[model samples]
Target: MNNKKIFAFVIFISLVVASILLLGKDMFSPYVSFEYAQAHPDKYVQVIGRLGNNVPANTEGKGYTFTMTGESDEQMAAWTAEAKPANFEHAEELVVIGKFSREKNIFVADKVLTKCPSKYKKENN
Candidate 1:
């Protein structure tokens, strides 16, 4: 093969590999279940589930505890998570970034995203 052709091929491969590596970060990012999260303490994770059923009230004045339903039938179990300031009860979806406790069956979420559904404008008023 010509030297120029070889050089082009190498450059193309390098670009492809680099782009893939960048996109691969999101593809391989660990989005773990409540159980899996609980097992791996000290690691941040994005947990998706319904906001209800297990979080205990913050008696110590720290956070709110709530249960999240897993996405699968086999893993469809209630997982606990802590939402700080005692106002997480109002969240639409609990996307928690935190770790879990296998023994306690709970997650210590550092951040919470409360999805509040907005009301649409009434037309023809």
Candidate 2:
């Protein structure tokens, strides 16, 4: 191939790689601490915490409202449009994926995953 053809090929490959990197960045959103999520309200983040003792209440067809407490004792209210998971009352931990709403001072979750404590315990002989 001529020098121009080779140069063109290299440029095309570089462009393709750059595009993939840029697009892939948005495909994975890392889990962040509650403090970080609160600081960056506009970005999507995943928060892992335990549900607070307060009972979760239904929100007029919008979703459910509950409180979540992080490792550091930082608590935040979270609302999820998704249906409540089975055995939610017995969940030992929760992983919530969504963004914070500064206006409402709550974490508006797109998805909610629950981890039940009893399900993972080994049977005693």
Candidate 3:
């Protein structure tokens, strides 16, 4: 290939690599601590915690309210405008994704993901 063709090919490949790196930077966000989420109320974040002691309560409409206990024992009030998941009570862990409302003192979740115990169930020998 000519010099110009080779140079253009290299530039194209470089641009593709850079674009992928930039786009994927925010694609896989790691779970944030409850404290961090609380502090950054404006930022959309994800928190993984075990289910709280209180039973998940149904809200006035179709929504539901629940609680989550963080790793350091941080108690967060969570509310979702969606029906409670069927496997919620059997979850070993919960991943709540949303922004915190500092004023309301609640983490309004956009989506709730339940980590079922079956994935980690012990098998008897």
lDDT of each: 0.60, 0.86, 0.86
Instruction: Return the lDDT, model 2, position 68.
Output: 91
Candidate 1 local Cα displacement, residue 107, angstroms: 0.6
**Candidate 3's residue-wise lDDT over 24-113, tens digit each?**
654466799989999999977889998887756556586888889988887888899877888988888999888899999999999999
**Candidate 2 residue pairs that clash:** none
lDDT of 1 by residue, 1-125 (tens): 99999999999999999999887654454667766666666666777765654544343345455556666622332333343534456655557665665566567666666665446646675
Candidate 2 error regions (>4 Å): 1-27, 118-120, 123-125
Q: What TM-score number comes out for model 1?
A: 0.50
Which run of 10 residues does model 3 get worst, by summed lDDT? 53-62
Write one digit per residue (lDDT tens) for candidate 2, span 9-105.
Answer: 9999999999988877644788789999999998888889998876565565868988898888878889999888877778889999989999999
Off by over 4 Å in 3: 1-27
Query: Who is ahead in lDDT, 1 or 3?
Result: 3
Query: Candidate 3 vs. truth: CA RMSD?
Result: 3.0
